[model samples]
Target: MTEEEIIRPENLVYKKPTLLNDTPMHYCPGCSHGVVHKLVAEVIEEMGMENKTVAISPVGCAVFAYNYIDVDWVEAAHGRAPAVASAIKRLWPDRLVFTYQGDGDLACIGTAESIHALNRGEHIAIIFINNAIYGMTGGQMAPTTLMGMKTATCPYGREADLHGYPLKFTEIAASLEGTCYVTRQSVHTVASIRKTKKAIRKAFENSMNGKGASLVEVVSTCNAGWKLSPEKANQWMEDNMFKFYPLGDLKDTATANDSH
Candidate 1:
């Protein structure tokens, strides 16, 4: 009838996933990378892929993801995770290969590689974290940064003439002929977390089944980079980020009537 009693296995409603290491996460207080990482770890454990999965992580805020997850990881050059994953998946067709990358790494510097990998239909999963600002690099502007959003590189706010436009990379991935599934999700609330977890699981499943490429794009919050409190960041994300990058399945070739 106390704290220990409530934490007892018989009364416990939730517990940390075993695949997640005991080490403390380095993500910022309100950042969503930790949540997404936990979900990925849970899915891997639930799927019994701890021994057959490989994660390729690139530079960005979530770059240290391998330190937290108990799995095989290959640290890739900046913006080269997808290409690295392609080679790994080719050599080990039976293993589940995936890439964990951020917006700057995927939508900007690695745009060509990310697109070509998906278009080629490599049997791999891609977990993309889109937090408008570049969180790890002094809050600079990224390709996914919303119009008028201010960042270190855009002190006066992003302008169309100078910044072009926010890239819809998920939609672009969905348009590819090779991608088996592509979905965009967020993790600000319990319901959203559940949805994102499900999407991530689907991505892993698709890869394991040789169904071609699958991309799970997580629209995340970077409170520290945004110069806002955790709560305000979530509120701002819902108010601004969600508008341009709505949550939904961009593509689902597995469910389509036409054969892949």
Candidate 2:
């Protein structure tokens, strides 16, 4: 077939999301951020909420998410994305507001903000990226770092006597009454990527419908920080990360309400 014939709409099997710009992502090879970004772009575009969507970008590796996704974006201070997203969502009830945050940003300094915003049932969505280690700042230890996992700050590996255990923030989110939907997902495989995309789309839909708050935690990988190749990182995540942070929905009041 000719190039033009192959390019025909009827022959096209897949295409890049229009909401995703031509900007080359800076995420390292094998990083999960790029896959999650593509999922977000596809979900937003499919929902036809491009013009009405507002994203609160965190101060971590995903800070530049605004550059790749074509949407209204607000840069939040370190660990303050939930607060900013809450405010925007309150002021513009009609707009779809969401926050993209890392484990360090959302579970450490922004813990209070994240908990309170969800507790208060803010009409917004929180997309949490938990890669265990701090990816942007030299692979330092984060609140979600698994036990015995070594990082720049935890060179001797994390010890309960000193660093404490990894925090399961999504589990806590599931307990909150304000949370309409809380789920943990991953993007390491094609099936998981599809599920994660569905989870994100559900969260966005809940936010736009003012169904309280939603938290979608994506268990991710940091190959560069872990000093492993992309392939090994995926294997490591499946072997170790999944053991500590199992995938699936923690809570889903939305589905319950639908059943009624």
TM-score of each: 0.96, 0.97
Clashing pairs in 2: none
lDDT (Cα atoms) of all candidates against the true structure: 0.93, 0.94
lDDT tens per residue, model 1, 142-187: 9999999999999999999998999999999999999999999999
Would you give me the overall lDDT of model 1? 0.93
Q: After superposition, how far is residue 88 of candidate 1 from its true place, in Å?
A: 0.6
Count the clashes in each prediction: 0, 0
Q: How accurate is candidate 2 locally (lDDT)?
A: 0.94
Model 1: colliding residue pairs: none
Worst ten in a row by lDDT for model 2: 9-18
